[model samples]
Target: MPNTASALELDAYLRLSRASLGEWLAAIRKISGCRDMACRLHNGGGPVGALSALESEQGFIVCIYASQGMDLTGCRTSDPVVLVPLGGEPQIARQGGRWQPLGKLIVARPEDRFHLRLPELGRVMIMRPRTDILNNLVNSNAGLPIAECHELIDCYLRRSLFFRDHNHARQMTSELFCRLGRIAREESKSGCDCSGLDRRLLRAVDKIRHEPDWDFNLTELASYAGVSERNLYYLMKRDAGITPYRLYQRNRLTRVRYRLVDCQCMVPHISRYAADEGFSHLGRFAALYREHFGELPSETAQWRRNLLEAESGHSEEPLAAP
Candidate 1:
C-alpha cells in the first residue's frame, strides 16, 4: 500500500483481496453509518494481502486479520490502531520501545510508529475515521472538544482491541460508532458549550496523573474544584463516562501498569505504590489489579522484568527461585 493512500483507497484494496480474514467489513458498515460500504477477498496467498480503508465522516474503517509468523513494517498510520492477541503471541516494536509481547487490548496511538513480528498465529484490528462525517461532526469549534474527542477515540480503540468474538465485537463496535455519530450530530446542531466543564474535568485528571501518590477523596477533590460533590460526580460522569472513584482507580492502575511493564518494579513493592495511591488494603489492591489487568500484580512485575531484559539485549534469566 502507498504511504499516502486514502482510507477509502485502502478499503477498496481490502474488498478486492481474498486474504482478508475475520468479520470486520460488515461490522464497519453497520456501526460507522457508511451507506456505500463494500469488501472483496483475494485468497491468492504468499502473506495475506494488506487491507486498508479510506477516511470518512460517518465512521472509521477497521481491519482484522489472523496471520502466522510474518514480519510487518510500516504498520504505522495517522490514526490509532487497537491490537489484541486473539491467539498466540507477537512482538511489537514502536518508537524507541522494543518488541514487547502483544497483550490483550493494546491501544497503539498515532504518535508511535509500529512494526510487528507474529511469533505464532495472531489476530489484529486496525480502525480509522470516516473523514467526511467526522469533519462534519467536528465542523464547529464547540461541537466536540478536542481533548474529549481524543478520549472518546482512545476509548473506542480500547474497546475494539478487547473484542473477543465476531458477533459481540461487531455489536459493540456498531454501538460505539453510532453513539459517536450521534454526539457529532447533536454538537453540530446544538452549538453547545462545554469548555468550563471540560477544563474542570481535565484539571481533575491532571491532578490524578501527577499526584498518584496523593490520597484523593471525592470531598477533597470537590473542594479543589470548588463544586459540590454532587455536581462533581455529574461532571465527571458526563465528561469521562465513569464515576470519580473509578476514574481515580483507572488513573492509578495506569500508573501501576507502566511501572510494572516499563520500570520493572518488584511485586511486593507494588503494594507500596498502591498504598501511596490510597489503597488501604493489600488484598483489595491485588484483587483490583488482577481484575483490571487480567493478571496478578506479581505476574505483571515479572513480565516487566522479562520484557526489559529482552529489550536490553540480555540473556533471559529465570526469576530468583521463587
Candidate 2:
C-alpha cells in the first residue's frame, strides 16, 4: 500500500472546486445513492469549496467534502455507510429526530434518513464498503481508534489504485479483515452490541421499514417473521419496547412525514401525503403524526414551504418605503 499522495494519482479520483450547493448535492447523490437529496446554504455566500470522491475496485467508495456552512437532507444509501468528520462542527439527525454531535466514526444504517448540518469550512469523510464489511461493522460496533482506521483507509486507497505489488495489497486486505474479526470478538465481550434482536424479528422489521404502506396485522407479520403471534409480540416488546403494530405505525408515519417535508415534492398537501402512506382517516392521521413527530402533518408541509421560500430569497411581507 502506498501513501495518500500516490493513491491520489488513481484514475477513479474525482475532484470539484468552487461548486454550488446544488452541484455538491448532485455529486453526493451519485456517490451515496441517496434519494430526494437537498441542501440549504447557511453561510449567505456561496458554499464555494472542494469535494472529491475515490472509488476502489473492491467496492469501497470514499467521499471527502469541504465546504461553507449548509444543511443537507437525504435518504441513506441502500447499504450502510461510515461517516467521519475531519474538521468543524457537524450534527446529524435521523427521521427528523434530535440532532446529535457528528464528529465521530458513526454507522448510518440503510433504513434511516439523515439530516446533516455542516458548519463553515467543514470537512467530512463518508465511506461505503462492501456489504459483508459493513454488516460486520454494524454488528460489532468496532469503536476502532481513529488513527488505526485512518491508516487502514490510506492503505485500502493505495490498494485500489494498484499502487503497490499485488502480494502486498492482498496482505493489507487480509490484515484489515483479521483486525475487524478481533475487534468483533472484543466488542462482544464488552457487551457493545447493537440490535441484539432475533434474526426473525430483524426480518420482520426490515419488511416493515421497506414497505411501510402495507397494513400488516399481527398474525401476518408473525407469519412473515416465521414466529408465532405470541412470540412475536414478546420479541417486539423486549427488543424495541414497542408493539409490532406500533413499529409498523411508526414507519408509516415516517413515510408520510418524508413525503410531506420533501423539498422536491410538487404537491405538499397533508391529506394526499397521508393517504399515500395508507392513512385514510385525516383526523386520526393528524393525531398520529403529531404524537409521533411532535407536529401536525400540516406543520411539516408548512415548514418545507417556508424553507423553500427562504432559499429562493422571497418573502410575503410587504416592503417598506426606501
Candidate 3:
C-alpha cells in the first residue's frame, strides 16, 4: 500500500523559499516560460521569497509567488494566463487597458500582454494551461468563458490551494474545461451575483466544502453566512442548485471518491473507507456512491490499481511456465 493515504496532503512539483530575488525570478521564469520577465522588489535589497509550482496530470502548471512587493514587466508570451490573487493588492493589465486590481480572477487571452504591479506584500498564482487544452477550447468555440464562471473557478482555486491534491486538481481542471465548453455552446445565460445572498451562499458553501465531515445544520450555516435560516436555504438552493444538507452530503461523497482512487489497496477496504467518511450505512452508502460516481467503490479501487500498474509498466498477463 502507498504510505501516503490521505488525499488532503500537499503535493507539489516544486516548493521552496528562494534565497535571493534573482533566484526567485529565475524560478518563476523557468516555469512560466517568460524568458524576458523582470521584477524589481519593493521590500529593500535583501529578502527571501516563497515560490511553489504544481503541474497537473493534464500539463497545467500553476505557480505561486509571494514577496513584499514588485513591479514586473517584459513578460510577452502568447499563452493564455490565469492570474488569481491570494493576498494583498496585486494588479495586472493588458497593453491598452489601465491596471485592474485582482478582484476574483483574471483570464488573459493570447492576444493580450500582461503588465503586473504589486505594491505591498502580495501573493498570487499564475496558471498556464496545457497547449492542447487551449487548442481544443478554441476549436470548440468555447473561447474561455471562465471569467463569467468565476464562482466555480473560485471554488476550484480555494479547494486546490487549501487541500493541495494533484489528483483532485487535475480532475478539476479538466472539469472546468468541459464546463466552459458547455457554457459557450449554450444560448441562454444565467449566473450568480457577487453581492447579497449569493455571496453569503458561496461563503457557506466554502465552509461546507472545506470541512465536509463536520455536522453542520441550518442554524449554524445561517450564522456562518450572516443571514436568516430562510434566506440561507433559499440562496443555497437558487445559487448552488442544491440544499445545504445535500451539498454537504455531496462533498462527503466526493471525498470518499478521492480516497478510493488514491488508495492502492484492494477493494475490500471500500466499506471501511466509506465508513470513515461518516457513512455508517454500508449498503446505502454504496448506492449513493455508485449513483454519484457512475461506478461502485470496488470498481473505483480496481480501476486505481489497474492505473497504477499500467503507469509502473507492470502487466496482468502471467509469464509462460519455464
Candidate 4:
C-alpha cells in the first residue's frame, strides 16, 4: 500500500489570482451548463482551490477550495448537483436571498437556482451528475431528494477515495450510478419488484456504456438487462424520461466528444474518430456534437490542444497560508 495524498492535485496555490480561479470555475460551469454566477473571495488573499479529474466522462470531479467568506451571487445549475459539507456549517440561500445553514447534503435539482456564502475558512466537495440521472433519482424519491442524494453517495464513497486512475475511476463510477439507480427500486412502495426493474434499467445503461460501438436495439438492451421490453420501457419512462436507445446514443456521442477534447493529437482526424465511436453518418455526427458540446468537435479539439500546449510550460506554485 502507498499513500497518494498528493497524486490528484491538478492545480495548487497558496494565494490564487481571481483570474486563475475563474478559469477552473468557468470550466466546471460551462460543462455543467451553468451560467450567471458571480464569486467573490472572503479574504483579501483571493480564492485558493485544487482540482482533480478523471479522463473518462464517467467519474466525479473532486475539488477542494479554501475560500470561505466567498460570496456567490446569482448561481444556478443545468445539472443535478450534490453539495457536500466538508468542514463547517455553510450558508446557502436559494430561490430567494435569505441565507440559512446548509443541511447534511444539499441536493439541487436541475435548473434550480441558489445563492451561497461559504463559511469563514470552510471547504466543500461538490459532485455534479448529469441532469437525466438526477431526474431518475428525483422521480423515484420525489419526497426525499436530499436524503436520497446523501444515501446514494454514501453507498458509493464507502469504499475508498477514488483517486486511483482513470480506468479504475470510470469502472467504479459506472457501478456507482448503477447502484444509485438500484436504490430507487428499494425505496419504492413496490419494493423488490420495482427495485428489480431499476436494476434492469441500469444494467441496460451500463451495457450501452460498456459497448458504445454496438448498435443496440431496445429489444437487445432489454434482453441484456434481464427484463421484458415493456418493463424496460416503463422504467425509463418513469425514471429517466428518455428511452433506452436515447441514453445509448448520448453515451456514444458524449464519449466521442470527451476523447476529442482529451486525447488531442493522438486522434488525428475528427471524422475517423467519430466514425470509430459508431457515429457512421458524419453529417448527423457533426450536428449532434455541436448540439451537445456547444461547438463542433474540431473546435473542441483545437481548444483542448491549446490548453495542453499551454500547460506544457506551466508550473505549479503552492499557495501560502494567510
Candidate 5:
C-alpha cells in the first residue's frame, strides 16, 4: 500500500525550525531535490515556519503546506503539477506573469520560478507525476506521444483542481492513471493483450466507488463486473492486492473519515452517514468506524462539532455521552 500521513505528522518528522528560514529551505532542498525554493515569512500569529513531505514511490509526489501567508518562488524538474487548497484562498502567478485569482483549488505548470502569494494559513496538496513512468506510458500507447501525454495530464490536473464536481474529477483521474499504468506494463511484455476480465474488474471497482450506498454483495458485484465470483476474487487479489470485501470496507471507512474530519459533521448523525455510505447494520458500522478512526462514532462527532463551534466563535456546551 502507498504510505500516507497528515501534514502535521510529516512536519514534525522533518523537524523544521521556525527560527531560521534558510535552514528550513535547505532541509527541503536536500530531501526533495527542490532547487531555488524559498518563501518569505508571513507576519501572523500562527507558527512561523512549517513544512511537510510525502514520498511518492510509484505514486505522485504530494506536499502539504500550512503556514501564515507568504510569497513563494521555486523551481523543480519540468513536470505536471496540481495544487489543491483545503482551506483559505491564494493567488498564483507564473514567473514574470499576471496574477490569477485562485480559489479553493488551483492547478498550474510553470517551467521555472512559479510565483504564489498566500494570504493566510492554507493547506494545499501538490501532486507531480513521475516523469519516467509517465513517458513509458506514452511510448507504449501508440496514439499518445510525450507531448500529447503531457497535455492529457495537464487537462486531468486542471479539471481535478478547478472543477466543482470533485467526485467526477477524482474518479476520472484514478481511472486514467490505472489504465495508463496497466497499458504500460502490458506493452513491456511480449504478446500481451487487454483481456475482457480487465474491463470487468475496472467496472466493478468504479461501481463500488460511485455507489457505496448500494446493497452490494460479492455475488452481485461479480455479476455486475461480468465475471464469476471466483474469478472476481482472483482478479481483485491480483490487481488491488486486497479482497473485494476489504476494499469495500476501506472505501466506506474513508468516506466516514472525510465526513468526520474534513466536513466536521456531528456524531449523532454518524449512523445516517454510514447508511449513506452503505452500512446497514449500526453495530458493524460503529465497530468499523471506531477501528478505522480510533474513536467512538459519538466522540468523533462531538470533536468535530467542538472544532466547528470554535472556528465559528461560538461557545458550545459539552456533548453528552451517547
Candidate 6:
C-alpha cells in the first residue's frame, strides 16, 4: 500500500530575513519568465521583511505568507492568485470596510486593484496557475462555486512548509489541482468573464489530469461533452493547440514527473513508477520529461534528495528555488 502518513514543521531555508529577502528578489529577477510585480511596503517597525515561502513544484503552485512584520498595501499582479491566510484576518484594501474575520479566502483577480494588510503575522499561501487553465476550469466546474473553498483552503495549507514524505507532495499536488479546477468551474459559471472553448477543452484536460489511467476514448470523451469527435478535434487545435489525446498524454507525463522528484531515502524505482502511470516506453518517457522539464528524471530526484540532506545538516547553503 502507498504511504498515507503525514507530519509537518518549518524548514530553515524558508527563513527569509531583510537581507536575504533582497537576495531572493534579486535572484528571482534573474529567472526568465518571472512576472513583473510591484509592491509598496508599509512596515510596522522596520521594513516588513520576514516571510515563509513554499512552492509545490510539480503542480507549478506557490504559497507565500507574511505575518505581523509588515503590511503590504496596494499590491498588484498581472495574474490571478488565490490567497489563503493561515492566521488572522488579512484585508485587501478595497474590502477594508467589510472584510470577514479569520476564515476568508480571497481570489485576487487581475482587475481587483487590491491592498493587503497582514497585521496578525499570519501566513498566506498563494497559488498561481496558468491564466488559460483557470479560464477552462472556471467555466466547466459543473456548478461548484469557488466561494465554498474557505474550509478546503484551510485544510490544503495546513501542512505549512513541511511535507512528511515524498508521497505527501504528490498527493497534495493532485488533490489541489482537482480542487482548483472545481473552484474555477464554479467561479466561471456565475459570470461572462471567460475564454477557451467554454470549458469543453478544460473538462477533457481535467478528466485526464485526475485520472491519467482512465480509459477515455476520443469518441466517448467528445460525446460526453455533447460534440462530435471532428468538432472536438478542431476546438482543441484552435484553443489549446493540441488534440485531446495529446493533452492526456502530457498529463500522464506529469504523473511520472511527480514520482521522479520523490524526496525519500528509499525512493521508488523510476521505471516502475513510470510504468505504473501507464508508460511502458521508459526511454520515451524520459525523453519527453527531459524535453518538457529540462532535466532527466533521475537528476531531478537526486536534486531533491540533496536538498533534504542539506536541510538535515543545517548547511547554510543558499536554497534552490522550486
The RMSD of every model to the true structure, in order and in angstroms, is 16.4, 18.3, 11.4, 13.5, 13.2, 13.8
Sort by TM-score, best first: 3, 4, 2, 6, 1, 5
Worst 10 residues of 2 by lDDT: 1-10
lDDT of 6 at 123: 52
CA lDDT of every candidate: 0.49, 0.59, 0.59, 0.53, 0.52, 0.50
Please rank every candidate by lDDT, starting with the best: 2, 3, 4, 5, 6, 1
Tens-digit lDDT track of model 4 for 99-126: 8887676666645587667665455556
Among all windows of ten consecutive residues in candidate 5, which has the lowest summed lDDT? 1-10
For candidate 5, list the clashing residue pairs, or say none: 267-301
Worst 10 residues of 1 by lDDT: 3-12
Summed backbone clashes in each candidate are: 25, 0, 0, 6, 1, 8
**Which candidate, 3 or 4, would have the higher lDDT against the true structure?**
3
Per-residue alpha-carbon lDDT of candidate 1 for residues 1-322, written as tens digits (9 for 90 to 100): 2211111122211221222222223223333233233332232233332233223333345443433345555455554544544335756788857888875445465566666655423445444435544454445345444444444544654333223223333455455555555555654222233334466666676676567567768888887777789988898777655677766775576555444433333334877777766677989988877665445667756644553454455745633211
lDDT per residue, candidate 6, 61-123, as tens digits? 433344234444334466666566655456655533444443555556666645555553455
Report the lDDT tens digits of candidate 5 across residue range 1-322. 1112232322212223232344445444544455577767677343434444333234343443445677666745355454545445766777668877655333354464566666655545454545655555445544433333344444443333222222333444455455445545554222222233367878887787568566659999999999999999998877554678766775666556445433333435777777887788989987776554345666655644553464454754532321
On lDDT, the stronger of 2 and 4 is 2
lDDT tens digits, residue span 50-140, model 3: 4545455454544454445786776666677667676677888787578889766566665676777775446666766566655544554
Cα TM-score per model: 0.41, 0.46, 0.48, 0.47, 0.41, 0.45
Clash list (residue pairs), candidate 4: 13-319, 14-318, 14-319, 14-320, 42-69, 185-195
Tens digits of per-residue lDDT for model 2, 1-322: 1112111222123233445565455546655667577777776666445444444333444444445677778757788787777667788898779989886777788677887877766766676666666676777654555555555554444333322222333444455544544454454222222334588988787787666457778888899999999999898777655678776776677666545534344456778777877889999988877665445766655544543443455755322110
* TM-score of candidate 6 on Cα atoms, chains taken together: 0.45
TM-score of 5: 0.41
Off by over 4 Å in 1: 1-197, 265-268, 309-322
Which regions in candidate 4 have their CA more than 4 angstroms from the true location? 1-21, 54-64, 145-164, 187-322
As a TM-score, model 3 comes out at 0.48
Best by TM-score: 3
CA shift of 288, model 6, Å: 0.3
